[model samples]
Target: MEIFAIQGYVDLVVFVVLLAVKLFAFINSLLWSAESYEAAGKLTKPAWTIILGIGVLLQFIGILFILSIAFTIAAFVYLADVRPALAGLRRR
Candidate 1:
């Protein structure tokens, strides 16, 4: 029983963290201009916004674990790749 309780807490933490990441990605996506995305040679702003938005919605719905993982990867991709590319353009 104690182990189960610990597992539940761990699961809750993971859920919250994933939600935060998705939200961050979605909000960050909204902050950048559409032209910036094109300049960065990435997907359009609307495309990323929609993708991150769906990830956030799915996090809330909490129905499909596989889909959640997939979107999490998407969020990370945006954060790790797209974000840096966009930021680099700002530096130029």
Candidate 2:
């Protein structure tokens, strides 16, 4: 298959996966906030830790999404620029 076509497909997949990540993050944030934890049991340290852990996980997940975006962009840039440069070198 052509390089452009393959890269386009990969970009589309990344976009869809990112969309799902956003939705899940929103839901999890709502579920892990103070109010949600308050509804779980007496407002204790452990309860707060659970809430804080959720926040940390959310941040980690956000980082993963950012990295995924970076990699996806890099993939396209490599295909558009680096690959062609390598191809030119190969033809010499």
Candidate 3:
């Protein structure tokens, strides 16, 4: 059906967007130091870095249904929640 075709395109767009988010989060995580993460109220920088790194690799492999959702939540939480807190501290 025409609707199904449209939905497929929509899904692909969403996936690509999410993948970009994950990659950005992963790169930032790698760039940030452990003390920065801790000051941002994050205890484990390596854990998040690894999580996002694997998430990106998996997305590239195109095996991202459950793994994508789980890691995407983690990545966004770090980006939206933790990164804001870190930025606030840096502005001081």
**Which candidate number would show the highest TM-score if scored against the true structure?**
1
Could you report the Cα RMSD, in angstroms, for every candidate shown?
0.6, 19.6, 1.6
Across residues 6-50, which tens digit of lDDT does each residue of candidate 3 receive?
999998998889889999989888877788888877757888888
Ten residues in a row with the worst lDDT in model 1? 60-69
Model 1 quality (TM-score): 0.97
Residue 37 local lDDT, model 3: 81
Clashes of 3: 0
Q: How well does candidate 3 match the true structure in TM-score terms?
A: 0.85
Expressed as tens digits, the lDDT of each residue in 1-92 for candidate 1 is 89999999999999999999999999999999999999999999999999999999999999888988899999999999999999999899
In Å, residue 89's CA in model 1 sits off its true spot by 1.1
Error of 3 at 4 (Å): 3.2
Per-model TM-score on C-alpha atoms: 0.97, 0.35, 0.85
> Could you tell me how far off, in angstroms, the CA of residue 52 lies in candidate 2 after the best superposition?
16
For all candidates in order, the CA lDDT equals: 0.95, 0.47, 0.84
Better of 1 and 3 by TM-score: 1
* Model 3: per-residue Cα lDDT at residue 48: 83
Segments in model 3 whose C-alpha atoms lie over 4 Å from true places: none
For all candidates, the clash counts are 0, 0, 0
Query: Which 10-residue window in model 3 sums to the lowest lDDT?
Result: 59-68
